[model samples]
Target: MKIDLTQDMIDQGLTCPVGKRKIEYCDAKEVPGLYVLVTSSASANSSYYLRWKQHGKTKHTRIARVTDITLAEARSRALTLRREIATGNLTEEREQKRKQQMTYSDLFEEYVTYKRPFKRSIGKDIQFYNLRIKARFGSRLLSSISRHDLQKFQADLIKEELSEATADLYLRLLKHSMSLAEQWEYIEKSPGKGLKLFNPDNAVENHLSKEELKRLVDVLMSDENRPVCQIVLWLLSTGARLNEALKARWEHIDRNKRQWTIPATNAKSKRSRVVPLNDTAMGILEQLETEGQHETLWVNAKTGKRYTTIQKVWQRLRLKAGLPHFRLHDARHSFAAMVANDGTTSLYAIGTLLGHKSNVSTRRYAKYSSDTLQSISNHASDVIQDAMNGDT
Candidate 1:
């Protein structure tokens, strides 16, 4: 039903008829399909909308609130919308504009929600966003972000004394987020395309020597550092990541088969792998099995809880062992180095033992694998000896 709506009618208030209280809309008398939408609250002002049928489908578009626009203005806007609908152009243009206006904060929120359930590193991503990305670019429109803005951001991070690697990580996260935005069509294109990453200084690869390993082992064997000792030993033996070892559970281990399974959730690569337990790794598990009543394989004897970190204890232990500074990750490197140095093991075998997802990562230890080099040298020496003896 259509009724001529005036300012007085709007100001004095128009109520839905008693029998039509369930209806949400009342149409205008002059403008067909133009409506004043009513709500359940009597005090609430009605809003203007246009509802029309085109090609057997209903299209509803909001005009404005009663307080914001006069009836004449609503009629004018509704007429324009009607023309656009007849021409078949308004809806897609309106939605495209809305997507082009999406801001960094908007995309980040959606990204976090989509990633939280599936991504293991989302916590770190959130930390990176909060600490660095949010404050500078959170409110900025995604379409407005440019290569220059990213370059400036990189310079700012460097000026703040962030290491090149850390600064690159921030840029990488931004690039990744923007890439997602592009994939989701929140932005037309990724602005981070063709951005050059900062070249980080060469990192020192620390591998413990036999003497140093002995000293470190002795220090770890002390009563106070036993929990950390066992953890480090496991790390050394299996070449598993620190977190993988810390979070190991008895259920994931098959002692009789001499295998320990690192669940995909607990692993960096998000792929579950079975690590063959060496004699040393098996021994540590057996000792812990006898001592631990809980389901977790590695736990603090004193607290009977999983060990979160051993950084503090490790720092002091390394100092007492008279070893040069080395991170806990270096233990994994040392394991790879030891295996690679053994004359029989191939780099592929070493990579398999370390549970590396790709051979590219395993290639870093090639320079440290003396076995291959030794074999090449021995072959050359044999050729030279054969020439000297006129055997060839």
Candidate 2:
């Protein structure tokens, strides 16, 4: 039977037929493909169903019970579902359920647990996530994070007075985490798939010039920020990264060999590297020993905690040194440049000293090698003189 669905019509209920009709259905006149199904005698409940012909096949789904929903609501819902049926968008409920699967925080905790076994920079990763990424995406669902969202985030990071390298590092971690989400089927695809790292050009290293280095030394001698300055001194002395120097433990130092061993957990390369210490580095260690006997190499006296970042210390020192743009990582470059220009050290020796795992990374200092520069200058002088003499 067919009728315009109404509260009064539904309230009256269906009349019984003479013979045993197993069931009865009435299609609503106001809305197409909407019907009420009544079971014969066996069941007292009735249900509203939405039916549609899709892709040459008949499909139907239960909307709601007649008792559970009002007649107006059933018709309104039926109208929406019918439009969606024509558009083949019937799986919106499944999409909503997918969005509730996992949050970025949940994924981050799981990713960290998976990575802590072998990732040397896991601590840095967690720190960056907490500082930069968590506020934006921590509670957001894995399935809901879109490429545009991450792109905007990447844009915001660069505008926040952070270096391009720092911003890129933040995105690099996100790219890997989201890639894992895609691989694990938590998300349909990684939103960071197309995100680009805005790697700064001519940014391989930013070593200090001799004049700037002298000024920095002057400020280091004058500054009262001893704890942070100590880390800066360690970095300048051994070319050790800030993290490697900050996390240095007393046990990792070989007093006899005058060598500092960076464990795989603290080493950025994920392998134990031995940094040979000079008198300058050894002297700093000796000075630190007089302060305390703790396993940690450097602790902030004010906080009594292991150092995380020397950014503020650097900001003050940079202004004082009049090298306002110099970054803490530049200390490593300055140390490498110092060694490279000594006229005796080879590129291979420079790489080993800095504990660089790759030769390509050490090659950036080729121009700084005095031997290489002097040899090139001699070649040019000989070529011009010889050519001038040859004509005579």
Candidate 3:
């Protein structure tokens, strides 16, 4: 069925009959353009589409509110669109030009300045977005972005010897940011639509071995940097993100309940999170609570100021443990892996503790076999036994 559209359709909205049909024509003042409505199935729930093209070579694209276009409005829109097509004035290129004025950096700056300050993961996301998008590709207009551009970025990252996972994260960030741009009408479409990202699921596990973990823990305990030591141990015990642990405050803790409440303002998902403090975590907090004079729980020893940089201390500890390539983030992974092995915590709990916003985040830690799990538990058991046996 083909309906001749008119102004009434645009003003009052049109309902397509229950069948495969198209809008053959439209009236002026009904709509600013012409449309073709397509229904794939007989079911009312099936999506209806409105498609239009600018000129001979321009491709047809989907339009919003296909159902809302009344017959008169549809006809009006169709006639105008036909005239424009005949005159060769309407072009996809022109439409694209209108969209390309907005860039990734524009949206990123807005998100960081306006949306980010209200979220808990602002610091991490700020670093991730700046490094991944705005610092490199952000200046470019969004509509001008193409798969070739992403390919170049990927190739550049590969030349820099960045891992497949790291490169993929950069790509994913682009797609996600562009998706937001698309939603906000900053771009007509997502340029990342056809690009493929590297799959990190095929990558080898980079978790620490038992001896390495023991050595790392020992080094942290013995190091004269007690603040960093406490921070490291707290990270290990609670499986919290570095920034989350760093920005932790005395007010967030409930000593009587042995729980830490991460306010929505400080949480990754913009939702409040409750972390049940383990005995190890509680002990560290009790010790720090007594010593900390600043608003934050973790403080610098030399000047009794809030500590800011743990990078240097982490590097030394990594070297002492004979694990130069290991990242502090792996400690959170180790925590989840160990907990999975012990069967003491659920994957959901582990994710909650680590501020992972999805089940996929915890799933990565649950891939160990029964034997690998036993090994993890055995190491934790041995350490506990040694601690109980008066080993310093």
Candidate 4:
């Protein structure tokens, strides 16, 4: 049936016929595929639609509501859709294009599957996403995320009492994820491009002095905290990282050769290295070897398993030694300082001993090497003065 849609008829509230299978609509007189769709009494408002047959299939496309667009505007839009349908563009193709856009959660899943296998700190990344990132932006579309969104996220992290370094880490991870999204074509470009990071003053070196080191060692030897004392002693002697020493296994050690091989899987650099053990390091390993029943080198006597942490016991030990301000990693710094102060070992040799992947890390100890140089300069001055006084 055909009818000219009037504003008075629309205002009176048009309804569909009783027992009709679908909404009863009247075809417009002026436009071929345009119709005034009268919904059932259950619906509050009526809308317009364009219907046509192409390639043995019927397609219906919604235009706009009668309350939103005028009759003249609906007719014009219907005409354009009819022309596109006649030119072989199907409505299903447009719907498929709309579904192709990826959301932030979608891209994050893909990134985890593709990138996490090779990342050393994948656990930390997953934790950050679950704890904060996913809750804030998971449902948002990838293209919808902007630099302002990332800036706000950084601010939120700071407001939550996270340290500046930690907040910077989270922001960096988000930026990295977005970059991966772009590489995989999920996004056109990273929204977090050129975003500023919090300035973390991580360059400050906190090392122990000789007197402080001696006191700490004495306290560790005297205290009942055997596991922490052993771990701290191992760190001081071998310069091994905390995680590396904690995960040490019996199979990797060679007592006869006085070497400990850090596997690529457990190493931060993801490359294996053979760490030569000094007499002191060898003694600690011998003690552990006699005491440990499991395959792992370091095991908690109480749990009969690998020691996961020594944070609390280490704090008490530091306090007992009167070095309450020192951190666990200061032992590593002390090792580098001790080696650099000897005046004989080159910076490259010190770096090799510390398992440093790059010279940039070892160069931080150059300041300690000045002590050795100053001593040599003083000795030379004394020798020159004695020769001049001899007058021979």
Candidate 5:
């Protein structure tokens, strides 16, 4: 009925709340707790009772009165109680009595410890963000964090010259940690609420054309370093991440099944994936078997240690080939493009082969594949001629 309760009504029975809804306190005959009175509309003939909750020596609040109450005012009172319970404000006084138990560092440490056995990159990424997070919000209790704190963290990363995509990754890590806190009931909402990540479309271009791929392969093959050449071929044939390929062990291969069983411990997605090794991929593996360094498939030529960084190797290869700044990881992009271009596999299968968790990540390969397909037949003669002349 939109009736506004006056001060006299509050002193008597009816009181207006924050938004000017009038409520009348009442004794519950049908329900277990105290009740409040409400009317459905301005012209409604009857009012109804809503159950009230009385906090012992703290404050009085309403919970529910009569389930069948149809008055608008009664429903509004019930709705308000529902919100209070949803946000866990029904017993704030009691909740505040417990001591604050954890800080951001404490929670982050828990997250790291829980994720330690899953993947090495998880450990590396946790350490990477740990320094930044501690520098900004170390002293603050986890309960005290808010969206503003996350905003400042993102701003600080931007100020440090981190590209938007990299900064967004750091922020997302924090968001994921905070989500764990939410699941533990440490907080009602994530501090990273309302945060928006920078669009990856603006940052790095990951795809490479077939010509670029041919040029890179040609340069690598002509170099005296045969290990890098084989590495390039395996990367292109398997579409694996650089780190994944570098850390591959002989123990993971099943020659009979023609599959490499990448363990969750070594995979970025924390899920083991079996990549089918094509004949070309198997040939590269066989070539590496002759190198006989360590049990690993790839190793450093100079130190004879398992290769870790492809930075210098990639730089020399690209510079010698007259290619612009493109990463070795682009080989995976080339593989996905070729597979999709030839119509040998669907986009979803391409994504699965690449170890991507979603179809969205795989969709980017579709564009390059579509473009490659249009000229596949026309370019065959030139590709053959270039290979014959050793001018690829």
Candidate 6:
């Protein structure tokens, strides 16, 4: 039904036919397509809407609940939306002129700063942006970025010999930033949505062979970066993450209990967990304490600060060991693989020792046959046992 909508008219209340769902009362005097829907239920909320046709189909956009705003406000918003729909511009010229376009670099700076204080992987975000993303999209205007631009960037990553996983990481950061930009009103919508992620699920854990383990150990023994090497050793022997090992302090460990308590603040899961220290790990700790490598567990003997990253030292060591493809994180995987493949430890037990919150983390190694697992377990079985039992 057509009527001039007013605060007094709506205040009088409305009703619909007994069998009908709701009724529409459109404003004929002011905004042509503006309407108010009054449902059959007396207590139900009545909503204002603006109706239009697109591609030979009727469309309706809700303005607001009648009770939430005055009649004047509803008409004003409806008229504005009508103009936006007709012109394909959501904002008025005054608004467009008031805000300058933000470049990708501007977004990157603001994004990193916003997330830096709490995000654990903020370092990688900065690294990827500076190393790859900034070169391509740094100066590009946020308004000008499209799905094609992102697609081309993804292709270039593959051409440059970057793996799909690495490309995915870069794009994931960019996409999330774009999403935030959209939320912040830099754009109408995110271009990153529906950009197909290139990497597929490959959950296979990287396990070091007997010879590779020996080579890594040999390299660790001779390397000048003794602190980082010990960190790597700690990761391998205890199945702890790099950050966990780096942030560990003397107070967190109990020699008599042979267990280290990871504080909730430092842990990835943000929960305090106690991991038993193996004989090998305990030996490394005892040596560190004797030498007084600060109060922190792993530190640069030369600089007297805790090792923030083992990447630089790891690169040199991996190359010297002729295992350039190996990553420091792979040491933890190798540790899990060793104990899991040995057949003595259950999957749940391995998850607990690795401080994994669930079995899914250890489930990948569960697929290997006994023969395949036994070969991988040869070197680290004793060390893993030491971790489980805290004794030889």
**Candidate-wise lDDT, in order:** 0.81, 0.80, 0.68, 0.80, 0.69, 0.81
What number of backbone clashes does candidate 3 have, counting pairs of residues 3 or more apart or in separate chains?
Answer: 26
Q: Candidate 6: minimum summed lDDT over ten consecutive residues — where?
A: 90-99
Query: Model 2 over residues 1-392: C-alpha lDDT tens digits?
Result: 67666788777775445565544355546888888777565233466777767556665566665666777888899999888766768754553465467799999987886677556679999999999799999999887899999999988987897888888899999999998676445677899997888878656567888888889888886788877777888899999988899888888888899999998788776678899999988888777742345668887777777788889779988999898778898899999999888878899999988888899898888989867688879989998999899953
CA-RMSD of model 3:
12.8
Q: What is the clash count of model 6?
A: 0
lDDT of 4 by residue, 273-303 (tens): 8889999988887676534468888888788
Question: What is the RMSD of candidate 4?
Answer: 20.9
Clashing pairs in 5: 34-52, 40-72, 51-64, 51-65
Any runs in candidate 3 off by more than 4 Å, and if so which?
1-188, 201-210, 289-292, 369-392
Model 3 lowest lDDT segment of ten: 41-50
For every candidate, C-alpha RMSD to the true structure in Å: 16.0, 20.7, 12.8, 20.9, 17.3, 14.5
- Pick the TM-score winner: 1
Ranking by TM-score: 1, 4, 5, 3, 6, 2
lDDT of 3 by residue, 126-224 (tens): 777766666677788777788788889888998989989889877876777776566445676778887888886774445667887888888877888
Q: Give the per-residue lDDT digits (tens) of candidate 1, residues 47-95.
A: 6888876668676666766666788888899889889877886775575
The sequence of per-residue lDDT tens digits that candidate 5 reaches over residues 1-392 is 23442324333434334554445544333222234444333111112433334443533343322323323445566567656655767565544443155777787876776555433668666666666877776677888989988988888889999999888878888888888677445677888877898866863556567677778778876887778778878888999988898889888989899999888877888689999999989888777753445788887868877888777777887888777677787778778878887755778888889999889888887775665565666589788989999995
Which segments of candidate 1 are over 4 A away from where they belong? Answer: 1-90, 199-204, 221-225, 289-292, 377-392
User: Number of clashing residue pairs in every model?
Assistant: 0, 0, 26, 0, 4, 0
lDDT of 1: 0.81
Reference-based TM-score, model 3: 0.56
Q: What is the TM-score of each candidate against the true structure?
A: 0.70, 0.51, 0.56, 0.63, 0.61, 0.54
Clashes of 4: 0
